[model samples]
Target: MANQTEVLRLLMANAPEYCSGDRLADELNISRTAIWKMVQGLQTAGYSIESRHGRGYRYVENNQLSVAGIQNGLDITPAVQLIVLPSVDSTNAYLKRMATRTPLTEPVVVVADSQTAGYGRSGRTFYSPGETGIYLSIGLPVTTDQPLDAGLLTTSTAVVVAQTLRQLFDVPVELKWVNDVLVNHHKVVGIMSEGITNLETGQISTVVVGIGINLTTAAFPSPLQSKAGAVLAHPTKVTRNQVIRQLLRTFFERYPSYRSGDFMPLYRQLSMVINQRVSLKSGARTYDGVVLDIAQTGALVVQLTDGRVQEFSSGEITKVNLLTGQYHG
Candidate 1:
């Protein structure tokens, strides 16, 4: 399969003005019929190709994103390892199983080409199309001596993802508070963190940060199509592999700050909720308030209408009824 992909890649790299069938066959040492079949296979693999009757084949000029390139581009420490799988139910679930067996010093990454049962918060179905996006999970072991605040971890991870995107692509990236990345007010990336802490020792044993991103999107379900977008949907062109490598590198660089308890200052630099109006909801309770600041512990400080301030932890957030600005009561 690798050899076949190499041949296809070579053909694509030399295409766009048409690589004659005879020339492609000679170059790949395969027959013209075999070359034809390979072209059809590439098309079926979500690659766009243009064929002309007498002119042979031409590639539509895509970024040719793949797992191999992503692995090569990642700049993680020796403790981190990359695992690429052909298919899986979910990257997060796979990492959870491996974390139990792998040593704390060794961090493992699980990446899937396709997902069978992708999910989100509250059991929401996450649409994970094969070979068209990025799905990955990272395994990290927090020290037994220092247990991180849950809210701080979430906000720090969010900042890491946003900064990575800024480094990799020329697109605008925004933080959706807790852990989501948006481009032009449309969600392009979702971050979910799961960890197991030893209550007796006050330490986090294992932490898994799962990331999902849309790289090249043609369409999505109508329900969320308008509210979500792909990185490529912006004016700039971005490949999945490029984004993945940058994300891993940025996370490692920021992990030290988080571990040293110096993340509060850095978190404030990237936070988006300071002095903004936001709607907060927890279970059956909901209220509107002006976002004053995000505390070092990761709670959002909001001043209510009655001149009182309230702090909220993890919850559903919105911008209130008005589409233009803040949701202050």
Candidate 2:
């Protein structure tokens, strides 16, 4: 571990209470001057640390997201490490490269304050403005006899994210088809799952699930302003670290059920378009249908206009009209 990381761990272990400079220096085997420098660096990086001449230093609970803060919040054994970045092209892209170069354990998470090239389903650009949203990707190792469809991972993540947000904010969150979480009919979260497959066995070796959330964004780019929204109109008691920790913890807890298809019931219940009329766009063809149900394998079972019921595993929902029961791409 780096000296700075160790210093943060010590401070977090004794948060809201002063950790004397002498004690910190002695424990970290560094000079008190070094401790002061580390504290200054942390403060510069957006951590709120309080210093008293005689009392030493204390980490104030300001509810901001930091590597140390997230580490402190997690209570699970075999701790999940966090890699926080100021800016990145995409968390998923970074972690994918890391996974190839290094062996990753389960539940490794990468978080970015902003992503310049964040993408969604069908390679659509995901808007990730700096300091206003959560752009995270979690890599999980899976070994199974059956091939894991990437869509299942996307749907399961959507369920976990929606459930976590609803529980945390006491708000209504709904899932739109395969990978979107909506609130008040506007998108708040976009999830995309990418996997590394074993060519010989055709099984997914690792799954990287990336999610972009609009937490407190005031305004979006003109292209997304009409349909994109944040979780809150303004900042609330919720902190970015809180959301990250809760999301990871909840996802791990629910992942087993999700894998076993037990989450299908709640997924169906939380869906925003189960019974609504929607336009399903698969490649060049578009079909208007009413959503009847969602299959356990994560396929959308739609009743088409010509009175034929069909299941689509992958498609873009171009448009959905609730009042007039009309849909079009």
Q: For this target, which candidate reaches the highest TM-score against the unseen true structure?
A: 2
**lDDT of candidate 1 over 278-320, digit per residue (tens):** 7778778887888788766677788987889988778867663
Cα lDDT, model 1, residue 183: 69
The candidate scoring highest on lDDT is 2
Candidate 1, position 99, lDDT:
69
Candidate 2 to truth, TM = 0.90
lDDT of 2 by residue, 1-329 (tens): 23776877888889878999999999888899999999999888778889999999997756556787776767764456679998999999998888767646566889998898999876889999887899999887766653455777778888889988987896778788888888767799998888866566776677889999998888888888788888888777777888888888888777655657778888999887888888889878999989999999899999999999999999888888774422221
User: Where is model 1 poorest over a 10-residue stretch in terms of lDDT?
Assistant: 320-329
Residue 212's lDDT in candidate 1 = 87
Q: What is the lDDT of residue 260 in candidate 2?
A: 72
Candidate 2 wrong stretches, greater than 4 Å:
77-81, 102-105, 145-147, 198-203, 324-329
